[model samples]
Structures are given as structure tokens and as C-alpha cells.
Target: RTVTLYAPASGIVLEKKVMQGQAITAGEELYTIADLSDVWVDAPLREADAGVVATGTSAILDFNSYPGHPFSGRVSYVYPTLGEQSRTVRARITVPNPNRLLKPGMYATVRLNTSAQSALAVPQSAVVQTGDRAIVFIDVGSGRLVPRAVTVGRSGSDYVEVLTGLKGGDRVVTSAQFLIDSESNLGEAMGAMSGMGTSPQGKK
Candidate 1:
């Protein structure tokens, strides 16, 4: 006697649990199949940025396999629980894979486009994080740069919200800020050393 087996759904075989003449048990697992017509991309959202994400939020995904090429998707679902260690919420995005280019286990970078709002913001490159505080160099006339500590709020891909320590139309150093900061510190140290060399009567 002979028996024939058939798959319930039409899909590419993802896993093969049994080989020819290897299995002879009833109700045993045989294979795993997955349809590639559509796929889900899991994205982790920062806790601070999760509030703006919704079901219909548009998302752009870039895959390592296809550099510079982006795939469009939308937020389909958001997980209820936040990652304990990562401190991020998982959001599921639905993307069509007609060409089957987006394979499983491929790494992707996701950018979500939420509703736009007005706020004081600066390019991310303008700010430097130092331990517990954030600092930005302000161009205070005559090519002099002053470092000012700032309070920051929610952040995006290219910019961060400036909650305090800056005003509208202020010029900030966006590049080579570390060099400027180093020079400023050096000048301060040299001035302090020079002052120590002087006596109370203004004589060295």
C-alpha cells in the first residue's frame, strides 16, 4: 500500500522536517511553508517616539541587500509591551514583496513619517552629548564660539528638539565642534595658569 501527501497551501518550502523514506508516523510534522507575496518588517521605536506612531503611519525601509533603494510600507500593528532591556516598542510594518527581494532575516532600517508639528529644533550634528548633559557651540561674534549646555526633548533622524538654552535665529556650530571645544578648554586653562603666576601686587 502507498500514501500520498500534499501541502495545504502553495508557498516556498522554508523548512523540510522529513526526507524520503525517513518518516512513517501519523500526524508528524513534515515541512514549513511561507508565502512571500507580502511580508512584515519589525521595527523598534524609542519610548519617547512611540506616541506619534499609529496604524496608518507611513514607513520607509532600506535593506542592506539593496543599497540606496527604499521600500514603502505602513504601520500595521504595534506591540503592547515595551522591551524591558531595549526600552523600545515593537511596531509591525506591512510591505509588499512582489519580487521576493526582501528575504527573511534580512536587516533593515526603518523611518516612520508621523504627523508634522512646529517646534524649535536643530540638526543632530549640532549637539554633542557629554556624560549627563548636551552641549552646542554658539557663534558669538568675531569668530568666537561659546559652548552652552542645553536641555533636549524628543529626537528624530536628522534633528533634535531644543527645549532650552537656545533661541530662534541662533547660529550653531554643526561641524568641527569638538576641535572648537578643545581649543576653548585649552584657552581657559592657559588663562588660569597665567593668573596664578601674578602676585597680589600685580607682580610676577
Candidate 2:
């Protein structure tokens, strides 16, 4: 008996999984099919950004090749695992490709419109992160910086919303914050050492 093998979808053969005259079993993969009916954009969202973005969130996609044209889509799935190295959560956005304009390998930038609210915020670069804690330098007085511990809620490219440990009308050190953080930590360490030296236990 003569048998004919057919690809699943009418598309280009991306990779040949089997060789000619090779022994193959039933339900084995022989060819790779590239289906373009629905294009999926697997974009990675940072840990902070992922926390705000939810499934079914609307997203605007802009491709470099498309120039002015923009594509709209909704997040279909959010992977349970985060990227090991990048620490980003993977999200799948399904874009209808009836026109077949968007390809699978196309590069795109996904802008997720997250819900907004009023909150205390500061420049993202101003906060210095140490281990799992977030630290910020406050301008207490002239040429003086005080390190304050803060809890951050949501973060953006330029700004981060502060959940607590800060108040309004407080001056924060945005520029050269790392230098100030180092100095503040050093001062605190020295003060603690000096206090320990003068304690009654020091004479024991």
C-alpha cells in the first residue's frame, strides 16, 4: 500500500525533522510547520512590571519594520515561571494575523497599559537596593544625607511608587544617590562602633 504524508498546516517547512527513507513511527514529527494565522508575541516583563500586569490586559505593539502601524492585542497567557537569568515573567499576547502581515520572528515592543492610581512616588534611580531591602537617601539638612528604609509598590522606567516609610515635602537625593548611601552607611557604622566603645561592657 502507498501512503502520503502531509503537513499539518499549509505553510513553509521550517525544519525537516525526519530524513528520506528513514524509519518513522506513528504520530512522529516529520516536518515543522510555520502557521501564520495567529501570531504570538512572547515578551518578557520585568518582575516589578509583571506584578501589575494581569491576564487579559490590553497591549499596544509597535514593530520596527511596520513603522507607523501599530497592532493591538490582549495577553492570552502568563507563564508561571520567571526567567532564570533575566528574572522576567513571560507573557503571551495573541495577535490576529488574518492579513498575514505580522510574522512570528518579527521584533516588537509591547506596551502594557496597567491600571493607575495616586501614590507617593520618586525617581527610580534615586532608590538604592541592598539585598531584598530598598534604601533611599533623604536630604535632611544642608549637605547632609540620611538613609531611610522604604517599601516600594510598583516601579516604572523613570519613577517608582513608594508604598510606605516616606512622607510628602521630603527632599530625596536623586542624583549621586549611591555615593550618599555609602556615606550614610559609613557614618552609621562609625557611630555604632563609637557607642559600643563607650558602653559599660567595654570596661569589662
Best by lDDT: 1
In the range 71-135, model 2's lDDT, one tens digit per residue, is: 99989999999888998999999887788898667899999887876789999887877679787
- Candidate 1 per-residue lDDT, tens place, 161-200, comes to 8989999989887753444356545344224324432111
> RMSDs, each prediction?
6.9, 6.6
Give the poorly placed runs of model 2, Cα more than 4 Å off. Answer: 6-12, 17-25, 178-204
What clash count goes with each model? 0, 0
* Distance from true location, Cα of 7 in model 2, Å: 4.6
Per-model TM-score versus the true fold: 0.66, 0.76
Q: For model 1, how many clashes?
A: 0
lDDT of 1 at 63: 94
RMSD, model 1, all Cα superposed? Answer: 6.9
Cand. 1 Cα-lDDT: 0.78
